[model samples]
Target: MCFEKCARCIGIALIPLAVLSVVADILLYFPNGETKYAEKDQLTTLVWFFEGIVGAGILMILPIVVFIGLKDNDCCGCCGNQDCGKSCAMLASVLVALIGMAGAGYCFIVSALGLSQGPYCLTELGWQYPFNSTNGRYLTNYTSWSECTEPKHVVTWNTTLFSILLVVSGVEIILCFVQLISGLVGGIVESCCHCQEIVRCNDIEVNVYEVQE
Candidate 1:
């Protein structure tokens, strides 16, 4: 029930989504290995990198679906006959979109949680673990969050990358859902219309034969 134009438009829109996720992942690379045990262990950067790849891969389905649809020039003419290629293509697209949605959704949730948790650290001030402050005098063999440099604890790069990952993947999830629905509904509608046309044609042929007899 959806026209080629509609599918094409959706496919075109998918390009940007893929690009955005890819870009976010590229940015995530900078902070991925920066997790130092002496500080907090922020896995946001690592998670973002992998999820961005998954999200980008999912977005690729739209373009492939569009390409297949375009290549099947006889789809409309052979409407009455089932075109396995078209059906398969649509099914494949739907499956890919579903996978993409799951991946993006996961990344979104993990990133959100990581953001809230503010990284994992046994103690906020590991750097100051060697010293303790008592009676206005600094003593050795003590560690506390109070002694750590506040600014050093903040992983600026990871925070920014994770924020970007969270936003881009969220957008991708919505797009994947839309793509799945459109492909499924459109393919079914087209198949039904083809069947109806074939029946109508058959009825016309039968009536003509009876009149001739």
Candidate 2:
């Protein structure tokens, strides 16, 4: 438990994460539809690859965990069980922070490194693709977005709120991670050294064990 008796602090730490998500939600105003494509360069592949990994790690994984925290762990003081409540509260807080940070990091990576793509172009199906480089050479050959001017999958934001959210979420997550490092590491080491100790773990207790008669 990184924070004892302060689930609120953990929750507060996620404020930046939530703020970034909210900011991303409102990022359609300015429009980043560049008409031109970027020129093919050494950095393009690396940028796109990093962007993909970051995207999956953040967007796909974070929201699900955070939602769990928001919905499940309300910190019921009425339980009157100190140990149970404390563990539950800490778990919820850590889950939320981890998920939020992952999401925020994805957004940041997308913003900074960006993804591989070209300008929009009409296809045989008649539906236009947002990033079709072969048709118009948007990203791999153009210098300015204007050369490939077209709507894209992700929106752009003028305000720096997203960056701010990323920073805030990163800090909170780092703190929470630090808190977990010692305890979780100790548990893992002990369990690895002696499997019987693992049997007692609340998180990994065997629901069913079979032995030949």
Candidate 2 structure quality by residue, lDDT tens digits, 1-213: 323323334444444555454444333222353323223221223233332234323443443343335333436732764444434544454555455456545655554333233223323443343443344343344344433223332212222333443454455446446434432443344334445444466334443332322
> Residue by residue across 1-213, what tens digits does model 1's lDDT show?
354455566566666766776666655543444435324533333454466666454546645365336435434444454554455555556776677677778768765554543433224544322222232122221233233343344344445656776886787677767777876876676667667877999999999999999
Residue 149, candidate 1: C-alpha displacement in angstroms: 5.1
Go through the candidates in order and give the clash count of each.
Answer: 1, 22
Output the TM-score of candidate 2.
Answer: 0.37
Q: Against the unseen true structure, what C-alpha lDDT does each candidate score?
A: 0.55, 0.39
Best by lDDT: 1
Question: For every model shown, what is its TM-score relative to the native structure?
Answer: 0.64, 0.37
